[model samples]
Target chain A: MAQIRCTDLTLAYDGVTVADGIDFTVNAGDYLCIVGENGSGKSTLVRALLGLKAPTSGSITFGDGLTAKEIGYLPQQTEIQRDFPASVREVVLSGCIGRFGHSLFYTKLQKDLAAYHMERMGIADLAKKCYRELSGGQQQRVRLARALCATGKLLLLDEPTAGLDPIVSRELYSLIEHLHKTEKITVVMVSHDLEAVMHDASHILHLKKKQLFFGTREEYLDSEIGKTFLGGAGNA
Target chain B: MLEMVFEMFTYPFMLRALGVGVLVSLCAALLGVSLVLKRYSMIGDGLSHVGFGALAIAAVANLSPLKVAIPIVVIAAFFLLRLSENSRLKGDSAIAVISTSALALGVLVISVGGGVNTDLNSYMFGSIYAMSGEDVTLSLILSAVVLFLFLLFYTRIFAVTFDESFARASGVRVGLYNMLIAALTAVTIVLGMRMMGAMLISALIIFPALTSMRVFKTFRGVVISSAAVAVICFVVGITLSYLLDAPGGASVVLTNLAAMLLFSLIGMVRKS
Candidate 1:
């Protein structure tokens, strides 16, 4: 069974429809990249998938033991984070907040889990450092480590490389791809970066306020819409 | 100076004011870190205005002010949170509208009930002598509750304040935690109003956090320093106010202002 299935989904807010008739399904170990232009409801879809916003119509169901709470999320950075006073360790440990059902503090096991992910993301040495003091790439790595701590099964990342330069963005993409291959974690990424999407994603779901295409990477490469988008995207 | 401090401590009213002031300041500083970082610093000010309006209504109706004001201010906090989350008028605009309306309502009610008297003056600028034993007891209990809840959910609160979307996705019940912060702020505002006044109570909430943020680079450091700053300022402000015959709330606010400037200076010096 598919890990997540969204059937005929329509998203709207403030009396305005943003996207309509969105349909997709993610099977286990699938590397799905959602590509779209600005205002194409890509963010809206990410929010819906995380169960933060309800769809205006249709349904989203999880199978293969997947639940909304179990999907690790690496959200885009916000203004609040720019000057936030928190250590890398503290921020990463916060990802384990969901595991504390009724406990007031984190357990030893959760701490170890956070530590492991931080080491995996190569940020263990920076654990005691202030998060905001780190460079943009390092900050994203810390966030990614936090996301890994949240869930070991799946990840939902929104524009994870929105700000970094080409070198750092490529490095982050490679890290994500390594996680996908070795850990066998399902990935759902929202991005505008066609280069990374073309190089890494196993499946593509293109959007322009609607589902323009949803198919395998080979199928997408051969499709007319994909060719047009890739050409237009490549020039820019 | 030591003898003067000893003299001030001899009075029963002074003792009560110090006790309540310490607890209220501690609660405000703890919540302030999250509020300041979340850009909801003005929330404390807004809720204090709602508290004032509630106090006015209670005075006119001959009811217990704390009892009446607590629930009204909490409900208003919830309303403000909901408005900011969903309404067209987002955060600061919503807070401004509600705060001004509530302040106006308070003034209107006070004037209709005859005129400004010692009760109004005491509530507006704050008088240490206004800290009745009963008010102290209530403030103690309420502040204990605020502190307990804050510590119990400290990590969750940190998560929600830092990143709401990620916290929500991680199954942290983001809405509940946000409401928890709002409700605690309401209770702290009401409790501090008798000692700090509605006009100046939010200084207790904002100044220490901002001052600590100037020097601290970590959340735990910021939180610990904010609490210490709050307690020291309260003690100093109370002492200065008693000695100089100044309004208690204004004295504290001035003390906080001085600390903020001093910390900013230190931060700049360290950077250079």
Candidate 2:
């Protein structure tokens, strides 16, 4: 069964159609990369998938029992959030709120889960440290741990490596790859770095203005548009 | 100090006013942290103007201001929320339009009422010396309601205030929560008006939150510390007003401002 399926999706703001007649499906454990230029509706599509924005004309059907609590999301980090006053532990604990919503108090089990995810993300030592005092890479790792605590089955990251150093970006991608392989979690990522995405992504969704190309990486590489777009690396 | 305390307790109005002031200040401090963080600190100022307008209209109709103010400010808050959701107006612009119009309408109503002794001075700048028992009761009830709601939705509110999109993605209803916050702001503005008044109410809401943020590491800490600071400033300011024979409302606001400035200076020194 498909983890997420969108049929004939159309999205707009103030009657201006940003994306129209879009269709996509993601099976369990599939790694999909969405690549596009600015204003190509990458964020809009993610918002629609997360139920933040209602598509104008489409049906988005999640698998049975797969609610929002089962979907991890890593949105783009902003400068304002970097200076926000919170500890790493507090931020990560927020992720567990989906499961523990308004319970008056958090149980020991929830704390353990939050700690486990922080440890898995290699930030257990920084749990009590101020979030703003952390390095950018460390912050991103904490954010990932937060998302992981919220959901374990599917991870959706929106431009997670946009402003990081090249080494940090590579490390982030490797960490994502490790999660994907080890946990068999479905990963849907939006990124502009085509080379890194091309190497790791099993499938690609290349979006242009009102156009979409969805296929396996091999199929995408063999296409004429792929060759033109990827500088003949389609043959690789 | 002992004599002043005995005198204060001897006067029923003074005791009632002090109770109202402390309760309203505590509620305002609790909600103010989120407002400051979201950069909507002016919301209290705007909503209080709406409350003032309602109070003036209620006076004209010979109705209770509390009853009239609650519904009017709540309706106006919903309208402000709707206008903010409209991408064209922007949040600050919406607040500016509503608040300015409401203040003008309130002043106009007062001017046309045959120059009667509307006691508009108290509403504009507060007059704790004339507070009644009814005012204290109203404030206590409103503060209790706000505290209960805050406790019930603390986690959801934390998520929405920190990162709205993340909260929405986690299946929390961002729009509902936003509306809830606006409604609470409206109620708090009305409840606080009898003590802080409309014009200076925003200061009461913003200053304590700012001072606490310099040292507190968590949202809950910010709320608690700000509330404590607000209560202290109110008590000290009231005492100073009695001893110095100055205006109580101005004294209170100035005390809060001094505290904020002192905290900021300390923070700068530590950083340096």
Candidate 3:
């Protein structure tokens, strides 16, 4: 089943269209990478998909009446957020709040789930450590674990590798790829790191101002725009 | 110490003032942590000025200041909330515009009327000595309501504080929560005005929260510790005011500042 479907979607702020008339779909277990330059409505499109912003026109439907708690998201890091004083465990547990509501009481299962995800993300030892004190790569991993705790069926990540060392970026991409393969979860990611995204993406969606091109990796490799932007067919 | 307690209990106004100060401080401390986290420490300052303006106007018009101030401040807070969301006006600019204009208008109204018989000094710097039983009851009721709301919306509040966009994405109504916070802040400003007065009210809102941040890791811990700190400051400040015969509002703010400094020193020592 298609986990996400957007039909004739248009998004605008203050009546100026950023991206318009977009049509897209993601099947279960599909790994789709949205590649675009800055100000090309990449983030805007992701915001619309996450329901953070309403589309000016068109309909977006998720499979089986999936609520927000069923979709995990990793947003781009900001300096202010990095300086926020919360422990790693505390940060991750916040993801479960969608399920737990406003109650201070937490079920044993929820606590165990948070711990399990942290361990799975290889940050179990840093659970008690302050989030602000972690290395950039480590912080990103913890955020990923936090996102994963909320939902494993579908994940939306925006600029997950931006501003990180190339090695760390590669590791993050590899981790996402591993999750896609092992968990069979559908993933939609917005990223400027084309090489890493193109390497793992089964499907590529290229976005420019008011335009979108959706195709398989092979088709993207054959296209003139993709070839020019990505450097070569091999890279695509 | 025993004699001092007896002196305090013997005076009805003193007992009432203490009750009002402690209750308002507790509620302010709880909300203050979230306010600081959201980088809106100045909001309390802004709203209190609005409250003061309403109070001056109400005093001149022979209306109950509490009745007039509550709705006016709440409306002003709503306006500030909406203005902040405009993305055109920066957050601080919006706060400055609302607060300064409201305060200036208030001053104009007072001056035009040649000032009411009310002592502005007490309102400006807080005269906890003048608190009546009605003020104490109002403070208690407001604090209870605020506390209930905070507990009811704790999870959504945490989500919004951590990441507003994320909270909205998770099906929480971001606009509703923002307005709710603004309204609560307005209520806090009005309730606090009686104890700390307009001039020094925000200090009560900010100091305890900042001091607690040095040690607390979780949001809940911050709230708890902030309240504890605020209660300490209020009790100590009131006691000192009684002994020293100083201004109650200024004394409370000074006490809060000292506590902050002491905590910072203790934290430094631990770090070293």
My TM-score estimates for the predictions, one after another, are 0.96, 0.94, 0.94
Candidate 2 residues B33-145, lDDT tens each?
87777766667778888888888888777788788999999998888767655643387787888898998898889778845657778879877765677777888888898
* Model 2 chain A poorest 10 in a row by lDDT: A227-236
lDDT per residue, candidate 1, A114-226, as tens digits?
A: 99999999999999999999999999999999999888889999999998999999999999999999999999999988888788899999988889999999999999999
Error of 2 at A22 (Å): 2.3
DockQ value of candidate 1:
0.85
Model 3, B151-222: lDDT tens digits are: 877766777777776666666777887888888888877977866878899988899989987766656677
Give model 1's docking category: high
lDDT of 2 at A93: 82
The digit string of per-residue lDDT tens for model 2 on A71-121 reads 899989864576577788888887876776657556798799999999999
- Could you tell me how far off, in angstroms, the CA of residue B229 lies in candidate 3 after the best superposition? 0.6
List the lowest-lDDT window of 10 residues for candidate 1 chain B.
B114-123
Q: What share of the true interface contacts does candidate 3 keep?
A: 0.31
Q: Could you give the CAPRI-style class of model 2? A: medium
What would you estimate as the lDDT of candidate 2? 0.82
TM-score of B-chain for each predicted structure, in order: 0.96, 0.93, 0.94
- Give me candidate 2's TM-score against the actual structure: 0.94
Error of 2 at A79 (Å): 5.4
Among the numbered candidates, top DockQ falls to 1
Model 3 segments beyond 4 Å from truth?
A64-69, A101-105, A232-236
**Among these predicted structures, which one has the highest lDDT?**
1
